[model samples]
Target: SGGLHGVGASVVNALSEFFLARSWRDGYEWTQEFSRGKPKSGLKKGKPTRTHGTMITFRPDPDVFSKTHFSYKTILAVSESKAFLNKGLKITVENKRDGEKPVTFRYNNGIQDYISRIVQGTTLVNQEPFYFEKEDDFKIECVVHWTIATDTEMHSYANSINTSDGGTHELAMKAGLTKAVRTYAERRNLIPKNIKSISPEDVYEGLYGIISVLVKNPQFQGQTKEKLNNPEINSPIDTAVKNACEAYLLANPTMADAVVKRVLLAAEARLASRAAKETVTRKLSSLKMNLPGKLADCSSNKVEDSELFIVEGDSAGGSAKMARDRKTQAVLALRGKILNVEQVASLEKIQTNNEIKNLLATLGCGVDQHFDLSKLRYGRVILMTDADVDGAHISVLLLTFIYRYMPGLISHGHIFLAMPPLYKIAAGKETFYAMDEMEKEKILAKLNGRKFDVGRFKGLGEMSPDILKETTMSPKTRTLMKVQVVDHKATGKVFERLMGKDPKARFVFIKERAEFAELDI
Candidate 1:
């Protein structure tokens, strides 16, 4: 695994305190043992077995690495990538730590199967992924598809080495595909002469593509081989891909039409977004820009020190404003439930929404390719809602927006949720704010028969400004759950099912998980 990981066979051996290698070939067995990279025993005879494969086992030296444990998921993922790159290759992964059954991945169709596997749960424009491979001069292989979801993913490789920060090879692939699609669409009279030609950005919207390039003398950007910079390799690969795509579309009219339609939609959105961005920029320049009137201003000019809270209502916003440090904390209250962006079709419509527009203006980070975290006004953006059914719904809606559009916010660890108390218990001039029933019960037990005044807050509006400051707004006392996306596909699937347009899927999801849901009232 080159760019895939930092580990290697010799490196592993050198860092291992104990190592063993066993090989069974041609009905004979051979074994060697090592300790701390030094061979303890020469090749020796071992028990014969039917299998003719080699096995290496090693225990890492504690002196070498801070952590000695292995990750099953990481191993499996690398193995899967290998199997995908090499057609007709079979790889089996096993993790004995958790007593789980072993799993094998064998792909006869190579990257096409890889694409199919990746897009299994997501809605596909076509059941089969678009694929092309050429072995002469320079080997170039590619598999691509469009998903119903918004995110676009690209993975490139050079001689089986995963180029995470792809270079010229990936660029060629993108250019080739864009040209091929535009050529086909123009020939098919799909686009009007008045409209602008489809650019790579437009074509890549909702696209999922995987590529691997093999060259005799591959030039890499660095010692780690994070990217391929071979100049000679681009044209040949591009021509091959372009030819393959042209032939594919000519052969499959239905799929070609579907692909063209998706590309056209992407083009429309891109144009619409450009216009909206221009308008927003002009407004901001004029200093008469539209932001949420309810948003309380922060005195701080430093980006790192500022924080923004998207509260549920005006009542909470007012309290939060009074409770906030003023120099750092800003608050913006929602007018009502926001449009579930997952269900929205047009990017223009979403931009036109007052709530979303205000957020974009205030945050200074645009969506999609236009987004820049450096321009973000606040270091932290927290969602503050009540601890009830409506609050939960609002939270999910806001989370969906952030997850789909400003995914980088979560990735950079800037998104958070403020945990305000649900109950206030007062007894003999002493008061405690409880987040849930468990805390309330504990407080009650402590008070015993002291006769305390117990009040359950229906929403954040019920809390006084001082109480709000003490329990939720103050950085010293507040409990903020920092949101993170550990798994993209799993998280995307959840948001899709919950916020997507498909009611049947939502019904099934609710039906399956209904028992675990707690009712507040």
Candidate 2:
């Protein structure tokens, strides 16, 4: 039996070479087969089976896919997400090829359990999660919690499908939370004497929440169920969550106290960060603080025409600075590894780090809420690090910083990772730069089985200034991957899992998807 009721299985079947669906209905079992969305055989009556369920098996068409093999881990992740949303549903996925045991996932606590799992590494302001379920001709349930971690994660769903793009329900929840928090803060004197009122942004600093709504007719914004579009459900959800949260806070004084304290701390930090940003602005306005002494900035004032390359070490930086075009490319050479801002609290503290300070100055945009996209000095912020494990780690750390503090940069498609060719295949006068195995094979094929001398480039430092420019730095030849946030909450969860101080959560995450990992020697 298989839990294959949604869009995925049908889509999978449509694109597959062979698909078989076995179903047990009433007192009998039946089987059917299809090939490329066409029915190969009609439903055949089978002997009565004791089991009451369905089983679907599909092999993807090789011609239709880059690779026909399916990722077992990807399927498991999808199943796990489904299991989290559905409270009582038991989902099991198995990789039958390797004799691997099936993975069982069943969450009785639903989204509440999911919240706990998500914030495993975080320091909670309120240990007891706020959960409420209400039904009045409609169904809506919400689970929310406040954490000391200075990141917000809010996920919404309609009929168990993730609404990553958000819709009416999400907007309503945000509005309700904003209103409720503001009202509660004002009433309880949670706001500091000097500060006026807490903004919605300030209040959501350390919040983690989940909202799930079940509707008879779900109006999805896209085919992918990226967003919910039912505007009618907004008022009902707002009322339910608002009333429930207000009552819960009033009843639980101790928990309310904790929440208020955390929010107040966030407010204070917000104020401090703003003040720091103002100071930076004042300094920049008053003093002529030139770009990093090591950097060779481009002449282009138009952000659209400019690209910034964040290179590792002064050696690579120097070469890049010399090699890059003066009119469009700016080189910022990092002396050492940057501060892993995931664990840091004060933005001021983060600003104190030499590398980060230089970066902040070079970028011309402040961090956190104070970050002004208009102030960005370059349109393309490319991370051009050594092609090694250390480079990858550095890139991840930089990404974490940007994601946590400068998310708008990513959202606006300003951030990019420069892909440098790994190997240079040369035969006689012919030379080929191969980025990966596939590219290498293509190049080899083009050579008509000619024996080629392969040269593996270890790092950026090894490459000459011309080679570096030709392979990575040159806009015409460079391969840059733009950073995109598909799901902000999912992205936040990944950062929380990988960079946070939770060994158990990291272990579980890695163990569950270990097979999918492409390890370097």
Candidate 3:
């Protein structure tokens, strides 16, 4: 139960036909070769090098594995996670056979760098990051920050391996944060004198932080290193963070004041939002309005059999409403773009928006932490937008909303993106749909130079209802890709780069990936 590097390399070596591990330690380099968990050669001298680290190369034995190759994304994700957790440690990846240039990643700011990357563009309570490190019998370092994004992003590690299923360290950190914030608020009279309580969940909204612990004996709960079972690590971290945060607050009175004010404002908004939701719930309970005016709901009472198509624009919505299976598919037409929930607090304001209000009323499920999955009317939430850049942006905005407010949607596998064809190729009525440029080329190659007519789908509005149903709306024929947050940190980095206010990051991202873009002309 070592760290990720040790565990991953061990597993790879155990399953490999031939494994070569080179280590540089104590001012010398050494190598070890293994086969099927048995060493082929003892420790041998390697070439002298200035660097001090280990390099493991292993080829999985075909006989041992159903698939011998490792996923590039998976490996890259692991490396990225390491870089994130370790901060200043330099990590690089290269494919030797392909002669690909090595990609180097290093972050001096640690989790603050992560927070800045994740909550880009969104307004923030404070520009400067809060950082603390404490070492005792149990060593721990924590970084905490908040962004304008109305979601919490946290990652915890024990001895450098990610604990996806957090352990005592995470629990302690949460407890510490809750206590520190509550005590500060009460001392400052931020909360009402009558109310004596505040929950951890309440304090964490719009917060992003990372906690890393190093212990000599780490008790992992599973083979995946998802949880830590070390009981001793909790109190040390709790005390350390409590002391550190208190000192930080006192030292940086201005920053602390701003944070407390923000939290107090959020608390007030939360109360108002709760009241609004109760009103909505009471109205629904009375059966005063069974459905929203804009929604063309499905007939099915069973949630599993029902699907909701969130269409952008009135024209696409009309087409979807007509093309939809009236018994199983519901359509909610969005009049215009909704507020970017990423940068907003109190989703109750979102509920005031006509489109969002209609959606909430139709679905009968609340938003944010108040959202009840059981109350949802649809099993599938499909984002059906035009096949253009604007449509893509709208879809992303919607995704950001869902990802922030109703993470359970993605976690439970209910979220999807509808893939409508970009080009409709027809050769004398022999029609074929090309989803992208690669598909268009493949279809052309299949035709063997035969003259064919091609029609580019400008948007969902341009397609007839029947064509929309066949190519994009119908469950039996449509291509729906389920949205997943496999690597939360990596996804956070991507969002920060693309949506963050930093002009330099967005420019670099666009320029680097420009070659992959396909021109519509």
**Against the true structure, whose lDDT is highest?**
1
List, residue by residue over 37-124, the lDDT tens digit for candidate 2. Answer: 8999998999986879888888888666532445676677668878888898999888888789999999998888888887887888
lDDT of each: 0.84, 0.81, 0.78
Per-residue lDDT of model 3, residues 1-521, tens digit only: 25453477667778889999888987779998999778999999867777787778777786654223445677777787678767798988886756778888798867667666765666777667668887778778887886656677777889888786688999898788778877887777777753456767666777777888989888888676778889887787777788778777777778887877766666666766777778766765785365766788889988998999998878888888989999999998888787676555677677677766776667666677667888888999899988778788889878877776777778667888998888899987688887777777777888988899888998888899999999998888878878877676567678767766677998999999999787765
The list of candidate 1 runs beyond 4 A from truth reads 3-15, 21-54, 62-69, 121-123, 126-128, 147-149, 222-224, 283-365, 373-403, 408-487, 494-521
- On the 0 to 100 scale, the lDDT of residue 212 in model 3 is 88
Clash totals in order: 0, 0, 3
Report each candidate's C-alpha RMSD, comma-separated, in the order given: 9.0, 6.7, 8.1
Poorly placed runs, candidate 3 (over 4 Å): 1-81, 93-103, 112-140, 146-169, 181-192, 213-240, 243-289, 292-306, 312-355, 368-374, 386-414, 424-432, 450-478, 482-521
Can you rank all candidates by lDDT, best first? 1, 2, 3
The whole-model C-alpha lDDT of candidate 3 against the native structure comes to: 0.78
Scored against the true structure, residue 75 in model 2 reaches a CA lDDT of 75
The better candidate by TM-score, 1 or 2, is 2
Candidate 3 residue-pair clash tally: 3
Which ten residues in a row are the worst by lDDT in model 2? 1-10
Q: If both were scored by TM-score, which would come out higher, candidate 1 or candidate 3?
A: 3
